[model samples]
Target: MQLILPLILFLVGFGAYEFFETRRAAYKIAHRIHVNGTRGKSSVTRLIGSGLRESGFQTLTKVTGTYPKLVMEDGTEEEIYRRTKANIIEQARMLRYAADRQVDAIVFECMAVQPQFQWIVEHQMVRSTVGVITNTRLDHLGEMGNSLEDITRALCNTIPFNGVVFTSEQKMFPLMEKIAKKRGTQLIYADPETVTDEDLRGFRYVEHRDNVALALAVCQHLGIPREKAMAGLHQTVPDSGALEVFDVDYIPYKRIRFANGFAANDPESTILVYNLVLERFDNGGKRIIVLTIRDDRLERAEQLAEAIVQHMPCDYVLLVGDSTDRVHDVLTALNFPRQQAISMGVASGEEVFEMVLDLTDDRSIVLGIGNMVGKYKSGTQIVNYFRHRSHITPKLEEETRA
Candidate 1:
């Protein structure tokens, strides 16, 4: 009992010191923008960071996406190697890194999924002066919640105290506003209409208008001119997992179009991207959807299977990763033609690519969705295979990796 008392006191003192140090680190930066949401958190974080840097602010950005990366002030990125599983404690490192650089601003993609951690990350660790929630979508249901409303509420836990919050979420703007008001913050809607098609043409890769608009809103609020911000955003480097379609010319077969949508973890975003691919490339070709599953993410695979069966129009559904047969069963039960669902259980990326080629004749549009990277289970290998074989220019090859 006597030893426990001293241990408790020591712990309390250590925590107080950490809290003070973290807050001091955060205060050293002129701008602290914390980005959260179901989708596009990494993209938005990168966009804001690039815009700030272009506007002459020494900015640092961190994105916890397909991989954790620390984008430095000069736009060079350093991969953050994780010694263990991801934790909110990593935010402390980000704060220290920013403070050491004496950055003018720091943009962080919120890595917390649990509700309590989300609140603590914002209220305690980051204490961002500006907050951005890309959009609310049905994702991470097991952690956030089942309903979209629940996800929105979980995301709102990142709303800063007495700071402006920005979002492109139309359905739940009111709810976010209510939460922001209680926190003495204002919620601003980032209307996508304001972002012109001309503005999107500057991007070298596929970028959503909603994401661009939201980033623009935050940059504008930071006193950057729209023209300047757009210019910076144009030059912004895409996340390594950003949507990119590559055209591969097989020696024996005709050209194959590979759309890397593996980073779209949620079904809704995947559906939207699939539809966009269909619209963009009207070439008559076999359409294939590769759904990569994880042993731990069977539920997500099931959700994606339903979305693919109901919404996406494709000739073949190639199931990869762990428990593919289970997802194939789910697909069949959803009325997806059994013959069309091919379960490539835990196949190597080369094996999957070979099967995709075997199924296609002349022209084929293949969309790789689901997990980007997993334990010995990743869609990136398949993507890399296509990327190596594709006729994409050296510049494109460089950009995609960035």
Candidate 2:
């Protein structure tokens, strides 16, 4: 009886998945576009969706950012999944749902986890009208083969034969260019830098420039007017937790928050954020760095800690996660101030925040970073709370109007 019941449940799940797959495949044939990259997939997807809407197109976006946010044509936001591994069947299922609702186009972000999945999901399942590859960076050391060749091959496999590829100049750009040409898909660069300061309302970060360029290039190809496309650029805001800074006054000191989640996906990114850390907060008083290294990527743990110490003069360090002791040792060994480093092992995000809060006086800058959002799924909310509290408005309305 136990065996029979288990088999029945398995059959039910399989059948449901198969149903979703078929429906999703049909939806793809109807309105298909695929965007894949190491970073900027979520931001670029959101930017593209917003741009399309400003141009009066019906759009549905399946976002696989640090979290899952699905944006419908009416600009409604729905929380889709809380757990990770948003599989190919699920990606297809979103298309099916979009088709039912009559969304004009479907924008999907491809997961580069098992790089080969890129080809199968995009080519065989939903083949795209427009394909995008952001930039190739060094992250994901465990699942992906160690060599850049392996990473590039897995990513390049998604070049669409029938669609255009809007990509950035990357280390593997030449190879990607070669593949796109061979497939006869026109390939172009997506440089955020192309969008001038006048187009964006307020202050801008360097990262958003390429994303803007990419979306504009793709939107223009679809025959959206270049002027309308340029106008939509005014509404752009930094993706949540991206390296944006805000100013707020709370008692003895004003707070500065660096939204670095976009810059936190990999060790090199983390190092870059730290470099920015040094550059921005030079001689800033009472610096408190609240950071967590994912238990999964312990390989980068030591280097990250060492990098933090080498780059920033963090007055006090609050470490979060199971690998705290190991990461702490790297800094302590370098004489990086043993008395200042504190660990919040296996603590909740709020708890970690409180620990930092207790340590923070009026004159401190709190830099919360690392691959926490992707790993913990709660990163954006926690980071968002800080942004909301410290003058970074949730809506980009004011800035857009500026």
Candidate 3:
């Protein structure tokens, strides 16, 4: 009965999508564009939109990354609330809005898993002049499967059959080329070093690599120069809630500090942060003290705790959340020495911060990972206290990795 319900829903949703696509193509389109990938789809969308505007064209862009949206040139914006089947109809509605503005081009983030999925939303989407595939990353394992190869295949859904397709320096482009070949789309390649697009120096110098580079390359192909592209890139505003870094400060600590990597959603990224903290803090002077899982992420809180216990020589473990006791099972299962780990029954960030403050002096480097990966803001409060109240500076390591 449960399966039958979903099937009925799919048929109705698919049928409505097809009808929208057919009505959508009636608008005279100057060109259509689509962008996709794991990390930078939204960033790439903004860059391409900026490039189009610089190239003497009116551009409308929709970014479906961490935030969902509808963006138009006159500087007005609206947030979209979508139902379970994903934002297909909301996307079609955006295209219609763009058409009304007579925008010369449209750039949108592509999240579907197959070419057929692309055909459904895009059949009525703007007539894209180009296609952009930002570099791929290992995410959405349950949906795209575990292997990198599978992730690449899923992202290829955004590449159109006949239009120009541009991909970043992704490791799996050769395989993507084969997919493009079946559709007759020639895969064009781009790199940050090429400096062909626009000067993108003003964008915090941090977010330049991942998806922004891919966007610049696509923008350059649309006829915007390196200088003009840079201007547009700088001129481009981060359409609000668009993955921004807000305050930065520092603290002298024998007590370690965590950047709250909890915002991480998948195991792959969490593992990377684990290695980073372990490698950097293995100085043996002060030990790594981590608040493994935040509140609201108690479901897999034990998994994160387990991973941390195995990979690092943790001085102590502070578990936060209603599921704090679950972590004890893993420690026992692994036979980790009991002297080093403890669950404090879902402590608040204020309590955690106070405990760490009372525990150490000015020599400890606290590594906070998996803060954002979960479903809470405990990490933010900790970081903010150190930043706005204490005023310490941290050398952010993500851009170097990017």
Candidate 4:
């Protein structure tokens, strides 16, 4: 009985301390924007924070996508290395960090997938003034749910009460509006059509128009002019894993263009970007598709294989990483040509680099997709190898000129 009493007292004291700490940090920041969605949360968080900073507000942004990063007010970013595995409690720590810096605003990407954790992050940790949902897609169905409605409900848990919310989701607007009404928050639909092709041309890298429109709406609501917000977006640094292109002339008399779309794991987004690349770069060369499969993400691999069989055109499909057997089965079932679809199995980045060189001659394009998580020849690692090789060519040319 005596020991139980002390333990209870300790628990009560710890709970009270955490409660007060969260509230104290929340009170320090005036504007907090919580970005939630199945995809594009990191990009939207960066865009909103950039727009706020350009409008003369001190903003701190945290993104838990691709890799975690803490974007500072001056547009520089530091990697957020976690001593332990990811937990929703990181949001609380970010709030405390922002409070310590006395930043004018905070933009945080929702890292939690469970509904209960999402609610805790929204109501307890952030208590954000603005909530942004980029879009709802069929990713993370195991944690969120299996259906689109379930995914919508899971994402809506972050909608702030009596606050402003924005989203570019087209099909789920009615459901989102109902949730906003229940929470006494105003929901605004951000139209991707508002951003024209000309506007998209402003970005340094390839980006979806819908994400830009969603961020623009939030910045406009906060009283920043649209033009200024766009300028800030133009200067914004894309997440490290964002879609990037690299041209490699590693082998003598051989040229290869690698479009790194490993981060877009969903079938819809993946296929869209793949088609975009094919259309934009009509080099009439051999188009090779690389799928970096993750053991835990077999469903994703299957879906991507089906999508590719349905629409995408490629000369070769190289499957790497763990659990690529399932992807191979799907392709075989779909009657994909045996010669065209080859399972390379798990390979190191350097090994894959050599394989890519062997597969292509002076004219070929390699499109990388699927999850970028693995030990040896992960998507990011392969992309980095090609990127580094591509850079060396320029330096060699510069030295030759001198």
Model 2 regions more than 4 Å off: 1-31, 81-85, 202-207, 236-240, 243-248, 253-263, 274-283, 310-313, 348-362, 374-381, 392-402
Error of 4 at 194 (Å): 1.5
lDDT of 1: 0.88
Clashing residue pairs in candidate 4, if any? Answer: none
Residue pairs with backbone atoms closer than 3 Å in model 2 (clashes): 191-210, 192-209, 192-210, 242-259, 243-259
Q: Model 4, range 1-402, lDDT digits (tens) per residue?
A: 889999999999998899889989998999999999977899889988988999998999999878899999999999998998899888898899999999999999999999889999999999989999988889887888999999999999999999999999989889999999999999999999999777777776767788899989999999999999988887779886677676777766788878888878899888888987776654567899999988778888899999889988788899998777778889989988877788888776677778878888677888999977655548878888878887534543332222
Window of ten residues with lowest summed lDDT in model 4: 393-402
| Candidate 1 stretches greater than 4 Å from native | 393-402
For residues 252-329, write the lDDT of model 1, one tens digit per residue: 568688888988878888898888777775357999998888998888889899999889988999998899899999
lDDT of 4 at 368: 90
The C-alpha local distance difference test score for the whole of candidate 2 amounts to: 0.68
Q: Model 2: which ten-residue window has the lowest total lDDT?
A: 393-402
Tens digit of lDDT per residue, candidate 2, span 1-402? Answer: 879999999999998887667646555444566888776777778778777877887888777765567887877788787455567767666766776777678777785477677777777666788888877766665656687766676777788895689887557888888888889988887776777756654335434556778888888988888788766544544455556654444444544443444346565566566665555543355677766667776766666677677766678887776578887888899898888988667666566556656665654566676654545544554565565556644442343223
- How do the residues 197-295 of candidate 3 rate in per-residue lDDT, one tens digit apiece? 224346643244545667667767777776677667665665332333322222533434443344343455566655654453333434544555644
Q: Cα lDDT of all candidates, in order?
A: 0.88, 0.68, 0.61, 0.86
Residue 329 displacement in candidate 2 (angstroms) = 1.4
RMSD of 1: 2.6
TM-score of each: 0.96, 0.81, 0.71, 0.94
The better candidate by lDDT, 1 or 4, is 1
